[model samples]
Target: MSDAHTADEGRAPRRVLVVMAHPDDVDYGAAGTVARWTAAGHDVRYCVVTDGDAGAEDPETDRAALAATRRGEQRDAAAVVGVKDVTFLGYPDGRVETGLALRRDVARVIRRCRPDLVLTHSPDRDLVHVKASHPDHRAVGSAVLDAVYPDARNPCAFPELLHQDGLAAWTVPEVWVRGGPVTNHHVDVTDTFHLKMTAIRAHVSQGGQSAEFEETMRARLAALARDAGLPDGRLCEAYLRIDTR
Candidate 1:
């Protein structure tokens, strides 16, 4: 869809939720697009499935410390994208599951956020490379999709959330999955690319030559934009739209 259509459509989402498996996943995949959404006056919330405890070195580093550090970094990243609320499910780094429990947690967030749209990883995240795809990504995506469907929208499911937490039933109208083969939507993020890069640079504990990774990340995003037929010199983020009609 074109930028003009996104701006003109009356149905454009006012509240958006982005669910991802790791702290930096959204920054790498969709932070620029999120900046666009927030700039358009939409409320954006970020939900990270894992604490990223396994992402750091220094064997003596406690899991709680790592989690705390990551959470702060995530919040900083969200701020860069103009998102004010950020949540973490506290699931383990590599062991997210697609079961009733995870679904319930995700459903609770969906209901509480009352987002008109949700964005998440592709269920088939291993399509590019088996070893490259993190298992947590697929698991979180599947659980989020289930939550957005009959679980979150249905008042009957996860009754505890409604009774105990005061979260109401909510049905998000659209879901956009990133890292899919059939990318049908592109968001012009030329104005937000630098913000995205800044967010990514905040994850300094995950040791690497910062200069190298940043350059590589910029090149990759540029290539992705080009592959999606975005105009030259315009950075973009791509996604596959799924209507929850």
Candidate 2:
């Protein structure tokens, strides 16, 4: 719940790693902020936890085809935000688990990326609204937090990551969890909202083009920024800061 923002002005720009459960999760939530970060010359990497095989509408689409299509879409979306390094763990689309195996995998990425800040789905999900609180999102978010904490920082927690993966222990100073009830910080992304929209649009195979859907998405982000006292036309992304130190 810390409001302490990391000042990137004086120090060398640090890498920012964003982890999500699905292909379009970052586009729907964190793309704007990611655009801002990349524009600021920060290195940004995306780690997608799922293959998103269940995201297509055409039941005739095979799992392999769906996964390949989603990977391409995610790459296109990531490119929109200037994110070139994207990793997909290939976990089942809707059945991510917050277990040691998953935690260790996340920790391996954190250690390899050595990010100063990590972003993932909000832990305190909206229970009343099932659409916004997907179980996979919750699972990935929780696993990322665990990986960022004692797991990633403590050498003993995931020693294999260090030995086999050439990843050293890394302690991310801050974490930003999006799409939750307990928002404590907002980033002004008006300049990048278009890029965000483009990123979201790249997931066309996932049915992101409906007029109603677009309007609702824009309105929600606008309302979120407004509620945080940001100016009009200043689109924003909100987060709950989890400071490890």
Candidate 3:
């Protein structure tokens, strides 16, 4: 962890690519910060590794239909934050693995997006919040990290992308990881907290619309804001900021 502060300032509008394991992962983790970025004119896109086919609490649910529904919900959620473009890789919901195939797929997206920054879950597990350290989340995070380093930047790693698809190698300059063990950056999302809540609520299949859920989320943000040294009543979203440049 570096320092608890906001993101890079005074930079021009940047292209940001967010990679997550499931549909509402971004909303639960860093939607507030993302809202702030888009409000500042950044171009943000999402690459959801899975369509959340296995998210339903009921095991008898139709997974294929659930996947389609979740994809639509994610798009609606993204629209609330001013983002439009979203890609779903259609990987199995609960069985994601940190393997070469996953890395290659993420690398392909990185090369295509050519984003200045990549945001994703932390590869590390959080003991305090075990749910944040889901296997799929860690797997996707690890794959994205691998893709950001050598795979996405090295054209030799995926020859097909160069010869067949013509997606030139792209180097992501920075990465912001959510649900990490430590947070070095904080975004004051008091202004856009409503937007974040709206985005979360858009995932109707996830059932987060209750007043108690909102209260719990508010308490969590308030605690994080205090950790960030923000004044009282301020809401914040925190991340582990890493410089890949």
Candidate 4:
């Protein structure tokens, strides 16, 4: 895992595809890195697998309204980081599965984007991150991994994609999975921490107790950076890097 993405100086993936289960999923761990990537001229696109209709915990929360709100919030969040392309698969939130349908959808985006790198959720469900390892997250991760491999790379895997959509096969070189038991890569995001917070703020429905959440989030970021071996006061995002090639 460590060998897959050692970040050779000045070498960056030309195009990056980020796949996640819900609207704010990517913002939780990788928003800062996304900002940094876009700042460096790397093209990053987001593929959100679900509408996140089931995100609100309150029984009175209007699911449909919440879904629409989340989608708009996500678009705003993406724009904050300079990302213009965001694809919402429109799958039912909290019920996504690693089925052929999910694979096909992910494969379509991968082929269309032709990204050299893909970032997604970790496949494993560690005890430390039971919430992050939600079933929907795991399902999306498994499907994304499969789609990045044979489904997106093999021309014959989904013939309809070629005959109907005109998408060609695409082979992605590397995938970096966020939030797992083992972290092999750390993206220094000190300079882009503020941008990350701004992006996170776009999800107005997700935050709580403004002052408390902001303070807690800052502390969490600091702890994450320290645990990931970053220099003092530097912000970092950890990932389990995998070589798809």
Point to the candidate with the largest lDDT: 3
lDDT of 2 at 102: 92
> What is candidate 2's lDDT per residue for 138-180, written digit by digit as tens?
9998999999988999988977887887788888999989877
Q: Determine the C-alpha RMSD for candidate 3 after optimal superposition of all C-alphas.
A: 1.2
In model 2, which regions exceed 4 Å deviation? Answer: 1-11, 210-212
Ranked candidates, highest lDDT first? 3, 4, 2, 1
lDDT of 3 by residue, 49-113 (tens): 99999999899999999999999999999999989999999999999999999999999999999
List, residue by residue over 1-245, the lDDT tens digit for candidate 4.
Answer: 23322232366648999999999998877988888788778899999999998888798999999999999999999999989999999999978889999999999999999998999998888788688789898899899999998899999998999999999999999999976778888777777778788888899888732767767777777777787666677667788888899
Q: By TM-score, how accurate is candidate 2?
A: 0.93
Which scores higher on TM-score, 1 or 3? 3
Question: lDDT tens string, model 1, 139-160?
Answer: 8888989999999999999889
Number of clashing residue pairs, candidate 1: 0
Which candidate number would show the highest TM-score if scored against the true structure?
3
Collision count for each candidate, in order? 0, 0, 0, 0
- In candidate 3, position 59 carries an lDDT of 96
Alpha-carbon lDDT of model 1: 0.81
Instruction: Give candidate 2's root-mean-square deviation (CA, Å).
Output: 2.3
TM-score of 4: 0.93
